[model samples]
Target: MASYGNDKEDYLKRLRRIEGQVRGLQKMIDDDKYCIDILTQVSAVTRALQSFSLGLLDEHLAGCVVDAAAKGGPEADAKVREASEAIARLVRS
Candidate 1:
């Protein structure tokens, strides 16, 4: 449930499409696709995943993080730390 409940279906569909793209990549490799062409597809998949992650992060910030901050206690601090860690991980990737 990392995704907002109402947005879950959209995320699922996006994931499924990315899954198909990955399978397509494998097939292309099996078929001896050009190296640059394969690399291009890989880039596309990476961008798609990053976009999806950012969307989920936005939702978390707008919902869970905001709510925790509003409460102004240990939970709020934890939420901020959690978000910072997540951003750091993404940046490293």
Candidate 2:
């Protein structure tokens, strides 16, 4: 029933990869790795997360928002507003 239901496995895979990157970061800290190297990995993880968020947002708009708009009612308006808020949050992040 969720917007991302179709691509749930893809999302989970991406999240798992990101999770591995985070664990690597922790190991880097434990090993006292170079500061710049650690920061680069941090940047990579941040970018990966941002990319994931954008993909999910696109799916929400394409699937959930589009479906709601097709129905033509208060739900449509709410979906659009909800999506707008999500975009704002993503932008702020």
Candidate 3:
């Protein structure tokens, strides 16, 4: 099963909203809007994407990592390492 199968719909909903935001941003550019206004929308979109990423990461840790760790073996170690790497990448971003 997919790691975030349960949240798949919620994720898609958020992504669609973000997609709309992106389209709005494009429109703002085409209309020759103020720099600050366009930048404000850009920041909102960035933060929304970050929030979505954190939520998915949370689910991965809670569901996938926890289950793997419960199994107690090489799979558990790999999962922990994978989760740590994911966190590192998120932090860097």
Candidate 4:
């Protein structure tokens, strides 16, 4: 919410689309689709998730992190640390 702010609706819409994609992938597997086709869809999903994470990270850096740094306090430091850790985890995924 901090990163997305007023654009919550847009983010949710994107997530819904990704959910549909995942459901489609499940259906394809259930239908015994080709292995390559399933792998292709899985790749697409991975990319989509990465894109989503990047967008959130951008917003967080631009808004929350920037505000925190400007304030310069324990709370600010904590926010920055949290953001860094979240980004690291995202990259690992």
Distance (Å) between predicted and true CA of 25, model 3?
A: 1.0
Tens digits of per-residue lDDT, candidate 2, 1-93, equal: 988998999999999999999999999999999999999999999999999999999999999999999998999999999999999999998
lDDT of each: 0.94, 0.97, 0.95, 0.91
Better of 1 and 2 by TM-score: 2
lDDT of candidate 3 over 39-70, digit per residue (tens): 99999999999999999999999999999999
Specify the highest-lDDT model's number. Answer: 2
Regions of candidate 3 where Cα sits further than 4 Å from its true position: none
Better candidate by lDDT, 1 or 3: 3
Q: Which stretches of candidate 2 lie over 4 Å from their true place?
A: none
Estimate the TM-score of every prediction: 0.96, 0.96, 0.93, 0.93
Candidate 2 clashing pairs, residues 3+ apart or interchain: none
Among all windows of 10 consecutive residues in model 4, the one with the lowest summed lDDT is 1-10
In terms of lDDT, model 3 sits at: 0.95
**Candidate 3: count of backbone clashes, pairs at least 3 residues apart or interchain:** 0
Best candidate per TM-score, number? 2
**Model 2 residue 43 CA deviation in Å:** 0.6
Residue 37 of model 1 has an lDDT of 99
